[model samples]
Target: MAKEMQKTSMFIERNPGDCENGDICKNLDDDGRVKRTGTWVTASAHIITAVIGSGVLSLAWAIAQLGWVAGPAVLMAFSFITYFTSTLLADCYRAPDPVHGKRNYTYMDVVRAYLGGRKVQLCGLAQYVNLLGVTIGYTITASISMVAVKRSNCFHKHGHHVKCQTSNNPFMVIFACIQIVLSQIPNFHNLSWLSIIAAIMSFAYSSIGLGLSIAKVAGGEHARTTLTGVTVGVDVSGSEKIWRTFQAIGDIAFAYAYSTVLVEIQDTIKSSPPENKSMKRATTLGVSTTTIFYVLCGLVGYAAFGNEAPGNFLTGFGFYEPFWLIDFANICIAIHLIGAYQVFAQPLFGFI
Candidate 1:
């Protein structure tokens, strides 16, 4: 019986594209689809791209308007707020079973589940509004920064804001549109390397500009007046007692305003495997990195200017000067923001 065993054996072999049920699995074959493998660095890069954008550049302006201590405090406060929102989403949201599986309920799903349909619609609309405002702000800031870099113009040449020239210069619109279009193209795979390079460029650029600002301020015979009065709009009027009280709360508002993305980030990481500790670790590192960077930029900008008022930091400190790196940073930021817009817009697109 042992000698005859090989004569009775039958073997079944499956091809690479075959399924266990003996079906040819064509579902994965050239369906205009691509798959990407993401490790910790890729995940971190994506999250960082979400968090750090055109907003960081405006930190100096916001903090200047609010106060010096208010800037870094805002960053820390926003970080925690975002973290808490993310945690809440992780605990409350649930996905349907695979047998009748639906795409997992996103943050919008949780909002709709808790708040109902009408509120969800309203919230979605509000998010679009926020996105629009954010986009416009970024585009304007980037274009202006581009001008400042290329023309060696003043950072805040109030008489000739760079955005004002766009109507006459068709090339600027063409370039901006091209950048926007490039951002919209789906090439999510293999972008981890691109993001890593961008992040490095961001750090290097900020470091050099910040260093120069610090040096000039240190050697200063104080070219600009050290700001004292809390200016409202363009007015240099002294801060009123009531306004000063309000200014104390300014950082909290700014911090919370930017905390909205935390929900999206939380949903993303929570979708990963339970055993994968790296997602959480990456998130923590990303938030910490952003916090440290913002704090350093804010503190240095404030100290160099010697003012508690936010605007004072920019002008009084002379630290917001046009550096070559700002141009590069703006482009990187625009690209990074395009990724973010894609992520945020996908759910809405699906619902529509």
Candidate 2:
């Protein structure tokens, strides 16, 4: 009997997955880590939270620069490119064989598995640097949104003519404090709630922006818009127009810049349906959803403000009458960025 017990223990140690009666093994996944509870829905939430960031707020300005002809075209082009590359990246979540092979936990892990040596280090360096930049950008954007909220209220109480100037330092400090607390979250697997909240906030603000643009267009207030975008010498100087056009393209590209965190997001998905298959479906759903929002926001915003669209319609002081709605939209932007900051920052935190 003792010999049989010892053999059972050895079997359990050698094959953890086969240990049906063991609590520890039952709690763990095939990879010997804590079980992953994420589904494609949660994965889509994370992707949406990461993809539709503060960058979406600038799509109006992007479309304004490119105008009717190239604006929609560029948006669609980037959408396709992002979706295509993301599907390919999803397949790389597992090495050699996506389903049965060993898991690659992060983007850097994926790189290390497929292309070892110096390439891994290079990928890590680039990825972390990009993540750092994105976090910094989110910090600034969140502060700006917070400041916009305050300024919107001030303008409503005072007058639009009043400067209502407010310092971003205090807001920045507040945003930093919030991030410091949220940064305590251990990993992507534990961030589903935050991502879901952030995803909701993203939709709230985006929908508000779209609604506002539709209202503005319906009110019959039209600004000049050319098929080729802002006129060369009339609306802007030759050099200014060229630079603005390039910057607009950059903004559109940046709006689809969540690919950096794709592998990390994929790591949280369960392995039953296969991680790659789940990730691909989530990617398709998330990107398709965002593309629809992007097209609506960009085109409708341009139609509302024409070539004179502000960089960010919410904070750019484009609509002033419905001040409460504007304030709420800005607040939503701030809330969304709070979670987004972590989504991008966790990979860097894990690496460290």
Candidate 3:
């Protein structure tokens, strides 16, 4: 047993402090080292965190813009594309064994190793943009959720646009503060609990939002909307229609922009046993689950609000019903997004 423990220590990550949870290990490699510590569950959380973010809050709005038939069609297409691209990415984690079993540690490594041109720089640029966009999106969403809960008059009349008295900036600043402390924990493996919690919160709010929408629709609270979904409230003519339609497509595209972490999160899985299959499984499970959630949210939100759906479904789910449920839903959103920021940012931090 002592000899086995000693052998294991060679590969085990040396954490900053003793792990409080026997299984959860938060550690860092001082010299940009990747540790193989994550299980399939942990990898799934990271993937889920990457795939589902603040963009989900706008899916219903996207559906409203694209109409029902087109909206769902686009989502299904994106799902298939993301799944294929994800698997292709997982296969890139390692090189042919003849090359001394070399591995591509970051997404940039793969680009530089294989593409070897101006494309490397472009990949880096895109990665930074993705990281920045994801971080900003989560930070903003978290702040909005916090604001929805803190303010008393968040929900009032259905047709009335209720505004929160408190500034969202303060809440964002507070999130940053909390994040700085949380970010100190270095290892992705250590955040297993956090990832699990985020996943649960995601399911929680999605279920609540869907359930309420169904109830409202069944109770005749909402008018029957067309299959195409909602409207952008713009005159349908010339480039105006074309531009907005494309813009809505771009919005849906943003929802699935989770490719940034493919290599890094896959790096967390053990290279033995399941081998190349670890990330494939994670991608399939995570993306599949998120797609279901997205469809439900988009359908339910559009059903309730039709053409009137706002840009953010969470804040605009329903004002009058049980206001507390809205608050609860937002609370879940805020918590999930906080973890999401770390999941997306960790890869950037690793690469840099």
Instruction: Judging by TM-score against the true structure, name the best candidate.
Output: 2
Residue-wise C-alpha lDDT for candidate 2, range 1-352, written one tens digit per residue: 9967543543243374567678657656776666788989999999999999867877888888999999999999999999999999999988888888888888988888999999998888888999999999999999999999989989999999999999999999999999999998867889999999999999999999999899989988887888988888788899999999999999998889888899999989888899999999999999999999999999999899888889998888888868899989999999999999999999989888
Q: Estimate each model's TM-score.
A: 0.65, 0.94, 0.83
lDDT of each: 0.48, 0.89, 0.75
Those runs of model 3 whose alpha carbons end farther than 4 Å from true positions after fitting are 1-35, 97-100, 152-163, 229-240
Tens digits of per-residue lDDT, candidate 3, 79-182, equal 99999998887777776541234667778887887787999999899998879887887898899889877653444543346554678999999999988988
Worst 10 residues of 1 by lDDT: 27-36
Candidates by TM-score, descending order: 2, 3, 1
Any idea how many clashes model 3 has? 3
lDDT of 1 by residue, 206-267 (tens): 56545654775687635322243235544344455346535534533443343344334333
Better of 2 and 3 by TM-score: 2
lDDT at 93, model 2: 88
